[model samples]
Target chain A: MAYQRKRICRFCEAGVQYIDYRDEKRVSRFLTERGKIIPRRVSGTCAKHQRMLSSAIKRARILSLLPFVSDNPA
Target chain B: MSELRNYEVTFIAEPNFDDERVNSLVGKYTEFIEKNGGTVEKVERMGKKRLAYAIEKRQYGYYIYTEVKMPGEAVAPLKRWFALSEDVFRHLAVRMTDRDVRLKAVTTEHYRKEMDRRNAATRPGAREGGFREGGREFREGGRPERRDD
Candidate 1:
């Protein structure tokens, strides 16, 4: 197997215990250009933080703080 | 019966509402919470802001968040009020769990530190616009290739 560097969870490194849905700017970083949630493997988020991040994204979408689907799929 | 628990209620009201109207609506909701065996701990008007997408054809909304302590029964009625009211376009009520309280403190501190770091690192012209920061990839899609048949 080829050697690969292990990726660390951004939230864990930052000591982020809670992912606030109101912080759309930060949450958007984990979304794709089409506004879909990036998979845990790709984002390098641990399972626990990934769960919290997904729920937070959903809540933000409900509040229209983040788009459900991007109009400009860049 | 479930004991009184703390909940954070957030709602988006019509952006066109005047300051007086907004204040009255806040008063009305606080009164309703009190009547339904809830105590209003705090009410914050987040003010008019743009929505990520149009809701009911409105591009902007006035956000109001309230922290309330109430019995479980009060949540249903509050939801019903939001659904029936024309003034409110959207609403969310979340019961604050023990973990949530702890996370709140942790996240707040982290956020403050993150902000300080960001401010220190940021320079003029570092960010061009709001659009690019959200997505990592940018591709030019101005024209599509056409094949003649």
Candidate 2:
């Protein structure tokens, strides 16, 4: 039997009203180590919040709070 | 100026600047803003930190954040001032709305959340390791392949 856990939107689950650009630590969780944002399908974030999250993450990267591209090990 | 609006300016300063020099620059900007009918609300110096990517072969940078109440047009001049400074490598001044102020509080809220997570992490039988920040293991493309064993 292949039973998978249901995916839920983190922001909706946590009651997070606003996504802040300066909160790098929290924002980093949504990003892959290579500094790429995880798609909403993979991350289970709603489309509306995903748009806001991506924009904020980009701003955070510009401010050096987040990396633009993580170093590749390969 | 019709009325003052809230604004936040953040910048990455050259790492070579000493505390004294950085303070002086902050003071100069504060004074300039005040002279322009803007009131500086607060300042935060995030100190030196490693850059995610090297800039001009420099691996580190100094971060500064300032919040002020000023006319909307004043931000352009402030940005120009930032550009003129040889020590400031990158800068941005964004007009802050009420929603932004509310969101800024969310940033601080995350700090509390982070601390709580750390505390829980250190508890007995908790994992000693942390998430790999390098993203070296992450694959960018599609979903996992399903295969019957």
Candidate 3:
């Protein structure tokens, strides 16, 4: 098997206890260019943190803090 | 008296309002929360910014966040009031409880320690591993490609 780089969960590493929906900048990093939430595998977020992140993203989207979908021309 | 609990509400306001009117709007909501038997802890005005998408044909929105302490039962009525309001576009109220507060403080710590233990038991440099969806290699077209011409 090819030697894959170790990918630690950034939130885990940074000790992110709670995912706040108001910080759009921090939330934006977890989203793709198309405004989709990056999965756990790609984002390297722990299961718990991933769950928290997804909910926060959804909540932010509802409050218009984040986009449901991107406006860019695909 | 009903036991007071914590809640954090965020609302989106119309961007067309002047600063004075916006301040008034915030004041009105704060008063509403107070009248609902809640003590407003802090009100954060996030200011106007471009919405990720247009809401009601407007490309921008104003945001205000309020943290308050009130009885759990009072939340529904306040939310209902927000829904009926004309100026507010969207609002979200998250009830904070003691259990949630404790969990937020400890989940990260426990998660970190668990990760450490798991990593220690693995191969010299094996990662804890992650899930990857090996989805379909070929794309399926909903409509026949090129109408099969």
For this target, which candidate reaches the highest TM-score against the unseen true structure?
A: 1
DockQ of each: 0.58, 0.27, 0.29
**Candidate 2 residue lDDT tens string, A1-74:** 57666578888766576787776877889998788999997888998789879988988888877888888721
Runs of candidate 2 with Cα error greater than 4 angstroms are A1-6, B106-149
Highest lDDT among the candidates is held by which one? 1
Tens-digit lDDT track for model 1 on B23-124?
999999999998998899999899999998999899999999888999999999999999998899899998899789788878898788657544533432
DockQ score, prediction 1: 0.58
A1-74 in candidate 3: lDDT tens per residue? 67666578888776677887777887888888898899988777889989989988998898887889986823
Cα lDDT tens digits, model 1, A1-67, are 6765667888887778999888889899999988999998777899999999999999999999898
Q: Kindly give the stretch of ten consecutive residues in candidate 3 chain B with the minimal lDDT sum.
A: B130-139
Model 3's CAPRI class? acceptable
TM-score ranking, high to low: 1, 2, 3
